[model samples]
Target: MNFFPNFANINECLEWVKRKDLALAKMELICQLLNHPEKKQKTIHIAGTNGKGSTVAFLTSIFQNSGLQVGTFTSPHLDDWNERIKVNGISITNHEFFLISQQIMSELEGKVQPTIFEFLTAVALYYFAEIKPVDLVIYEVGVGGKYDATNVISPLVCGITNIDYDHLNYLGNTLTDIAQKKAGIIKKDIPCFTTETKPQILSLLQKISQEKQSKLCKISPAKKFIFDSSQLITNFCLTAKKHTFNLKTKMLGQHQIKNASLAVNMVLYLQKYFPQITQSSIEKGIKEAFWPSRMELISQEPLIFLDGAHNLGGIKSLIQTLKTFFPAKKPIFLISIMKDKQVDKILNTLKKIACQIIFTEIPETRRQEISKLKHNNTAKFHKITDYSKAFFSFYSLLDNQKIGIICGSLHFTALIKREFLMNLNEKLNNFSLSNHQPV
Candidate 1:
C-alpha cells in the first residue's frame, strides 16, 4: 500500500538484495521500463563469464576516440557507484546520479517499484538519451546476458568475451546452460562476435546465430599474433577483413589482449556498417581504455597489485598475468570472496603462489566468512574481519622489497582503495600539523 522509502541510496539497494530472489524479478522490471516511451538508441551489449568490463571499456574508448560522444553502463562498480555510469570516461556526478534516482522513483510511485539494477539501467538509458551529444552507447549486462536488464536495448552488435563456470545457481549448473543464457544477448539480425570459445559454447553460438540469422565471428587467441607483455602494456593484433595491423593496449593480461581484439573487431563491424570508424580511431581507443581492479597496480613501494578475478577463469588469468608480470618470487596476498563463489578452487590456486594470506571481507552482505576458507596445507593465514584492518595488517608485514597482492572481489579492491586513500590523507594532515609546515 505504501512505497515511501523508494530506495534512498545505494546502501539501501545493497540491503534490498538480501530480501529478493536474484533471478527473473529484475528482468521483468526491465521489460516494463523498456515498454515506456523514454527508451532510446541502439546499444552494444556485452556478456561473458570474464572480461566484460574490460571489453566495454575498450569499445567506449574507441567510439570516443572517433569523436562520437559515448555513454557506457557497467556494473559492480569497483570504487564508486558513479563508475557504473559514465560519459566519455567521466563518471556521472553524485548530484546527477541522485537526480536521476529521484526522477525514476517519482515515475514508479504508483506502479511496481523497479529493482535497484533495473532502476539504474533505466536511469542510464534515460540520461544518455536526454543528453544531446551521445552518438553510441555500450551496455554491460549486470548478470547473465539472456534476461539482463541491459538486454532491453536491442543492441546493434553483441559480444561474448569468454564462457566459464559462473553464477551457476542463477544461470545454470552446466557450461552449456550458462552459454545458452549468455547467448541470449544475440539479437535477431544483429552481428555477434566472440573471443576464445569452447566447443560447447561455440556450438550454442552457432545454433543461436543460425536461428536469428545473425553473423557469427569467432576469434581464437592462438590464431592471432601476440608480440609482448609487461606490467603496463599488452600488445597484439587479430586478422579482421584481411589485415594484421598492430594493436597495442595499456590494459594488462593476455586474456585482456583477446578482449581488446574482440572490441577492435566490433569497431570494424561498425566501420563496415557506419563507414565512419577509422583504423586510427580504433588504435587510439584500445590504447587509452582502462578498467580498474584488473591487474591494477595501486602502490609502488611494496608493489601492491589489485585484481577483481572473482571467478575461476578470471582467477586463472590473474595468476598467469602475475607470473608473467612479476616473475621474481611469490607475493603476499590479501584475499576475500563472495559467499556464493567457488572459494575452494580459488584458495587451492592461491595456496600454491601466496607466501602469506590475509583473509578479510568486503563491506557487503554477500561476503564469505574468512574463517570458512579451507586451507590445503597449514600455511600462514591471518584472519582480519575488517577490510581497513586487513589492509593495515598486510601492509605492516610487507617490506619495501616484497610484492603485495590484494584480490578476490572487485568490491574488496574498491573498499581497500578508498580506505587507503583516506588513511594517506589523515597521515599527511597529521604530519603537516606535527611539523607546523602550513598555517
Candidate 2:
C-alpha cells in the first residue's frame, strides 16, 4: 500500500472526502491566506437539498445569453473534478486545473491542512478573481450553508431551492433544523429568493431573513407550465410580474419547473445591478439550457432514461415524473445508492414502480455494499456488484421492448455516463445521442 504522494504534487490536491466538524476555520484561513480573492467577485449563492444544480444551470444560461461573463462552481461532480468549475458553460481544462491546484498546494505547504472542499473553494474563488475576468459567478453550497467551504462570500443575492431531508447527521433530524442550516446563507440587507413550499421551512427562513435584516422573496411555480411529453420539446411558460414568456427545455420532471422558476426569479432580483438581462434573453437561455443527468433520455426505442435521484424526496419526484411521461408503460428500474442515504425508504419507494430491480455499485468508496443489502420480496430484486455488466444486460432487455430507467446515486449515474453513453450510441440503431454533455 502507498500513501502521501508528496503534498507538493498536484495529484495530492485532487483527493476528496466528505468533511466532518461543521467548522469554517480551515476555509476562512485558506481564504485569508489567499488574500480573500473571493471578495473581488460578485456571486449568487444557492443552497438546498436538491434542485441547486438545475437552478445554477438555468441562471448560468440566462447570464451568458445576456452577454455577461459567468463563472459557476458546483459540487459532488459527475465525472472529473473539472466539472465542478466552469466559466460560460465550459469546464476548466486539464492544464488550468493542475496549475491552480499546484499553486494552492504551494501556498498551504506545512501551514494548514484544508479539507478537499475548502481547498477547491479557495482554488475556484482565486481563479475567478485573479485569472479570469467574469461579470458574475454562481456557486452552489456543497452541504449545509453555514459551515460549507463555499459559504465564504457575501453574495449579491441568495437563492435557496426546496429544503428536504438529507445529511441528517450533520444538518439535523428535523426539517426545521435543516431549514436553519440552509438559511445560514441569508445575510443582512441582501435580497434572497427561494422556492421552498413547505410551510414550516418557509416560515423558518422568513424569520431568519427578518432577523438578519435580509429581504426574502418567495417564488411561486409557473401558473401555466406545460409538461406534455406528447410535445416534442418540453415548454415552460414562466411569468414575472406582467412579463410572460414561453421557454423550451429537454429537462423533464415537475421539480425542474420549480427550479427554473427560482432561477428566473434570481435573475429578476439581480436586475437592479445588471440591467442588461431582459425577458427575451431569459427565454432564449431557458430554451438552450439543459442540465445533464436529471431526467435525461439516451434512447428513443425502449425509452432509456437516467436520473440522479438519491434521496427520498427526489425519488418521490422521480416516480411522479415517470407516471407523467410514460403513463402507459411500466419501467424496469436499475438502481444503486449511497450508504448514508435513507436506504430503507429509498428501497421502498422504488419498489412501488419497479417490476424488476437491479441493484449494483459504482466505482466510488461511499457506495452501499451488495452483500449488506436486504433481500426484498416486493419486486424481482437482483443484486450485482459490477454496474457496467448489469447496465449492458438492462440495455439488451430494453432492445427487446422493455421500458427502463436508471435511478440511483449520482456517482453511479456518472460512472454509467462516462463508460456506457458512447457505447450506447455505437450500439444503438445508427443514432447518436446529443443529450449527454461532456463529463
Highest lDDT model number = 2
Alpha-carbon RMSD of each model: 8.2, 8.2
lDDT per model, in order? 0.77, 0.82
Alpha-carbon deviation at 214 in model 1, angstroms: 1.8
Writing each residue's lDDT as its tens digit, candidate 2 over 168-234 gives: 9999989998889889889999988998888878889999999999998999877555666665366
Each prediction's TM-score versus the true structure: 0.85, 0.89
Tell how far residue 104 is off in model 2, in angstroms. 2.3
Whole-model alpha-carbon lDDT for candidate 2: 0.82
